[model samples]
Target: MTGTGLDDERAYLRECRAAIRRMAEGARLNVVIGERVAGDRYSAERLGYDLRSLAKELDEQPDGPPFFGRLDFGPGSAEHHGQRYYIGRRHVSGGPGRAPMVIDWRAPVSATFYRASARDPRGVSVRRRFGWSREPVALTGFEDEHLEAGQDLGVASRIVAAEIERPRVGPMRDIVATIQPEQDELVRAGLEGSICVQGAPGTGKTAVGLHRAAYLLYTHRQRLARGGVLILGPNQAFLGYVSAVLPALGEVDVEQTTVDRLLARGPLQGDDGEAAAAVKHDVRMAEVLRRALYRRVTAPPGPITVPDGSYRWRVGQEEFGAIVTAALREATPYGVGRERVLSRIVAVLLRRAEARGRSASAAWRRGMTRALSAHVDAVWPATQPEEVLAELLGDPASLAGAADGILTPGEQSAILWARPPRSFRSARWSAADAVLLDEVSGLLERPRGYGHIVVDEAQDLSAMQCRAVARRSEHGSITVLGDLAQGTTPWAARGWREHLSHLGKPEAELIALTTGFRVPAAVVTLANRLLEVLTVDVPRTRSFRADGRLRIRETSDLGPATVAAVRDALGHEGSIALIAADATLGPLAATLRAEGIEVATLDDIASAARVTAVPAAMAKGLEYDHVVVAEPAEIVEAEPRGLNRLYVVLTRAVSRLDVLHTRPLPAWLAPPAGVQG
Candidate 1:
């Protein structure tokens, strides 16, 4: 390309930026005018909210380009004949009488930009990719692939490589400009379809999931907005890491939360063994809870009597017991059945009055129903989730009744509290208990469902947890995202089929993304060695960028070596993470701080320090530019499926990785010095 060509592209970029500014300004004015012309208080309030949301969407990001690629179409195309279209994150139009200055990447016409190639032009004549600096305000360079005959398409795009290799800073950014053909297929997948992405580490599965959410919002805005879209991550740290991606794509309404937060019950206190927690999280626990809850509906202790004005209605113990038994046989939830039982008792009294030649008014029946409430309350009480779960864990008789033929005596005892608390308020609940409470809460009352849910790190969710998440989206669809190889929990899913069935999305289409764009080739290659030991058969991922450097250091003084590694990593341009075993994170963070190094723990959400000390377990869905692993052996020994955890720790690096270990690396990871595995 010559100077004239460069100048022409620069001028076109400037023109496009001006158009975007005008479009944003016009949108702001429309919202302001709408707010002023509101007819009532409700309309005004709604207009204000819409205005705030529009302002967020139209807000200019200083470090982001309005458009990334431009396509020139030949004559006789479906839309825009012999016209040029700029594909960008958000749509921008020229004033009223002019054509659109930029087309949204999610638009049908712009699909050619991402899908077209020399092999298949798809009506596109030329594709141009503009390169920008980190700030993305000015066009630094341009690359064009001409599809006309006798014209070279040029070598592979340096701009694409540069964008993929961009240094990591802050949270993950939108991959709008650099979305691969495979990723675009998933992103453009219809809103009604549920896709389960089984991607290897660094394969950009999380990004693909978020982008799909944004795309569906764009395509089915009103439907999804009414039902709502939710993104479920593993923890707060992971949620905070990817929170910015959707906003950057002009989608601000998608809810991003964790399973525990979404369940919204209990403080996650108390403890349970792995075996006990697994048993509680089993799908069979749903039936056990059902038995425990309905057990509260026993036969009436005595006859019921009600007084209305000068008349009294009496129901014998046998009749009342028969009514309760019939109501319980309805198989409805306890809360719902209790009301039916009470209504039936009132009906029996009303029928008796009619048979004796006495008339009962509507008001008289209402009065009788209220007067009989005390007897019904004593027989079939209204129970809360926490109250029932507490009884199930504390009382031996209730446990045995609910667990009979379902759980062994040892398994039942494992879940029972050694010293039962007096009440629900005094009881401590663990993470697993929160899931059980969610299950019971759903049974008592129908849970509200979202329009769509994106479950990230889904393999780590237990069967009960999946049920809880599925209940919230029972009427909608789901996007399940995770790699089985990265599963670290005891109840991690062995297969996507079993997992999706628990999520109530058994027919969801499964998509595998085997090409990695985040982690470098060398890092993923080293991590893939663990696949030999693990039973999972994940495909080897291909990296887009050059191989990153991997250095292994041997040191007797672990603290000093880790600190030195952190200092060395700080010299890089992007974020640095020092990963160690959970037990070692506290002391290692303290040691780093004591050495005058500013370090932030992963749990500290408020801190944005460049150097963060992350535990191996919490580092599942996160990535950093430079990573320092303190000890490989400790991470492998941390849990039963520790090899999976170590694989996750090793692949977190995007630019470089330094492995500092005082102890010998696990034999599976590090073979004999002279012999290669």
Candidate 2:
């Protein structure tokens, strides 16, 4: 098996598949094939015969008939129609090189199978004859099959299926099974009203999302042949990253994008959507309000409050600027009164909404009008009337448009949110495409112009953000994924469901992806250990032990013992990562660098490095070889923001772990004290 040739490999594969098929039949076991891009690879050999038996299945049949010799395109063939083509319901022609193409397994004449043309290969055409359709069935007995593989007069043969089956398994595995689940389950769940999967970090949230897409395509191949779903990835990198998952699962590719990309298409895309002028108008209003709030808050007698109570405070006015300059000169790490004033304005609008029979948004607009009228009367003594009103309610659209060209780097900070991209609009504004927002918790705002909504990483989203997501989709299902322990968003509060009432979503459908499939039991153990919250004054440590089997190793060092622990972990195989809470990034990075150890910032590592040090904040959505929590105490006491971050960092370690820290470890992190090696 070491260097088997292709034909030999094929024979071995055939034999193995036959054996697995027999085992599956005997056990009434369903097979879930993993990593199935090509049909040539073997089934399994490691992780014990029983576990491997359940790991995957390799079908002897090619992706299609054998006559075509596997029609899969080579890497990078997605462009030029060499590979990847979209098959819409009515034969939509041509798309990105990465789009999916339809392959017909059933044809009256094997050679007459139709494929969408490379460039508008509009109609079906006969290609070549395939062989497998005419081949006769080959049958064999289970004992004979096992004997052919030739186990020498073996010791009592292992009860490959019987002895290995565990009736009651950990809940996490159940979740993983459901997340991607078996194909039949996928078919059943796909058409079911709505589905929700709340996956924590390392829980394969994105993986399940991709699988779900494929499942829909495979089960409902006819309906999905046309565009039936939309995928919203977190960003472009993510779009490219998870693109292959669906195709691997035999799914027709659907649309994928970011929220900004979707918004561009929502109301701004066509005649049916909002006209560009109206969009521009809103842009202007946003700017006018921004400037009005800036000026109103910086006036001589402190800040000004409008009748409805919306107020503004300037961050860089001359007097306050001077105080900040003095403080910076004194190297003050802490500053006071940096409250975002416009948010207060929004809150005031909410308060006024309760007073008047109007929505908060409507009341806020009325309040702004009243505030401008009052500002005109008071400020007219010193300024011209036109200038006063103009400054108070500046033209935001013109300002925003101009920002595209003339604004300086510092002044153009808001430009990123200025406008939506154009491709996201529906051809018909009312079409409720099944919408999926991957890593939904991180979206900046609820996407506009969607009829239905689905979200992943719900736990990481703040309550307010979730509400925003709910507001964007009208009369559509909202599916979310999250893990309570991996709540990395600094602003996110636990129990995001509490805000579901505000968003108008049902609370009963909340789903949890509790399976620990991506990370081993050891990694989960380490993360849960550091994250064990106290209930009724008792440490919730026992909750960490999901199933006692550790597919991966777990390691740790209490506070004040990290440096030595780091030194020891460094001596092991594989790279290391040191995750910290504060500005300790640069210093510890430099320190580790001085020791000739590889160290990198979390942002940098997020983009490239496999094993490197990083701050907890930057380590979200990523993992590492051996992760070291530099200051668990700092995370617990001074920076609660880092607690979720620490959870993310610890889960990165697949085979090993090293949680280093200073000061005594918190009750959540203390190893069973003396119960050690």
Candidate 3:
């Protein structure tokens, strides 16, 4: 490229940036003016909020390129044919009369930048990618792939490779600049139907899910903003890791949280065995809770007697019992049905007042109904989720009655609290117990649902947990992202079908992302050994980069070996993670600290840190440029599906993986060094 061409590109970029700054300034002025001349308090507050959001959308990041790619379309193809469109994270307009300075990547016109290729140009004449410095101020270089010249382009784009191979420093960056055509399809998938993505490590599943949320929010802003979108990850650590992707992509309203946090009931205490937890998480538990809660609405002890003015209105026990039974049988929420039952009692009192030849005023009848509070309390008590769960777990007799056909005696016993608290307020609930409580709460009262939900790492969510999440999306859609082979939890999903079914999204389209872009070919090849043991059929993933290194080091001193590995990985360009069993994190961190090495744990948000010691269990949705696995054997022995855990640990590396093990590696991972098949 000539110097004049480079200078022209630089000049154009500056013009775009300037236009964005002007738009942001206009947004700020609108906020100020709207705040001062508001019609009312509510209007003022609403205008302030909307303008602030607009300003945020137009906010420029010093360290991010204003635009990453540009597409020049041919004549008669688009409304802006013969014009170039700069694709960016958000839309930036010059003014009402002038054309948009930059188009959001989610825009339909900008789709050509990602979907166009040498074979299928989609009427695109030229596609250009801009390379920026770390600070992203200067336009260092630009690469142009001309589609109209009939040039035979290669299989891969150098620009895309450079962007993908960029050394990431902070939390997971948005992949807007390097989204592949296949990924672009999923990201632009409509908001009407849910999508289930089964992607291997380095397949960009998490990134795709987040980007899809951004796209949905962009396309259906008013609809989604009203009900809102939610991104559910495995844990807070994972949530924190991917927190910036949406914001970076010009979306700031989506809620990111974990299943535990979403269910939000108890201080997660106590533990249950895998079997026990699975049993409790069974969908049948919903039925059991229903029976237990409805059982409380038994036959009224006696007829209700209401004294009105000078008359005593007496209703027979048979009539009251029949109404209570019919109300209980109604397919409605407990609270809703209870209200109907109260109305029925009111009707009975009104009829009795009419029969006594005494005219009762509306106010008088209401008073007579209110006077039957004692009777109503005894018949249909207001039951809370916690109170119902406590009684179900505390009273063995009640448990048996509810779980007769639903759960075996052993299963019931397993779920029963050993030392049941005196009340729901004092109950100590486990994570699984919290899920059960959420179920009962939903049954008693319909929980609020989101417009859309993105459930990353969905494979690890149990049936009941999925149901809890599904309840929140009952009227909306979801994006389910996970790799069945990476399911480390004991109750991990058996397949996408099972998971989708449990999530009440059986119609969701299952999309498989088999290309590994982050993990190197060698690392992915090494990790796929665990697939033989996993029952589900997971597609083999191919990596874009074949230069990733994988080495297994057998050492006597594992801690020192880990320290040495971390020291060596620090010499690399990207983030380094030292993954170990949960029990080994404390000692390993202490060892590294003793060695004068600054180490951050997974729980700590350490995006800037060059090195982090992450527990093997928490490494599911996280990635690193260089990963050092300390004692793979320990990770494999840590849980029931530890081999799957090992696979997850090994595939977290984007560039290199160093397996430092003092014990023998799992036999399924690889054969003995000297042995042949």
* Candidate closer to the true structure by lDDT (higher is better), 2 or 3: 3
Higher-scoring candidate on lDDT, 1 or 2: 1
Report how far residue 520 has shifted in candidate 1, in Å.
1.4
Instruction: Give the runs in model 3 whose Cα sits over 4 Å from its true position.
Output: 1-4, 56-60, 76-78, 151-155, 273-275, 314-318, 348-362, 606-608, 671-677
Each candidate: what lDDT?
A: 0.84, 0.40, 0.84
Q: Give stretches of model 2 more than 4 Å off.
A: 1-9, 12-188, 199-203, 220-244, 247-454, 471-478, 488-493, 499-504, 529-576, 600-609, 637-641, 673-677
Which candidate number maximizes lDDT? 1
lDDT of the structure predicted as candidate 3: 0.84
- Quote the positional error of residue 194 for candidate 3 in Å: 0.8
Per-residue lDDT for 366-414 in model 3, tens only?
7866887678879889889989988998999999998897898888888
Top TM-score: which candidate number?
A: 3
lDDT of 2 at 272: 16
| lDDT of each residue in 31-55, candidate 1, tens digit only | 8798889999999998888886786
**Candidate 2 least-lDDT 10 residues:** 430-439
Tens digits of per-residue lDDT for model 2 on 418-503? Answer: 33334222122221111111112112122343433445445554443444455554345444545556565454436645545534
lDDT of 1: 0.84
lDDT of 1 at 606: 74
Local error of candidate 1 at 426, Å? 1.8
Following a full C-alpha superposition, what root-mean-square deviation does model 3 have from the true structure? 2.8
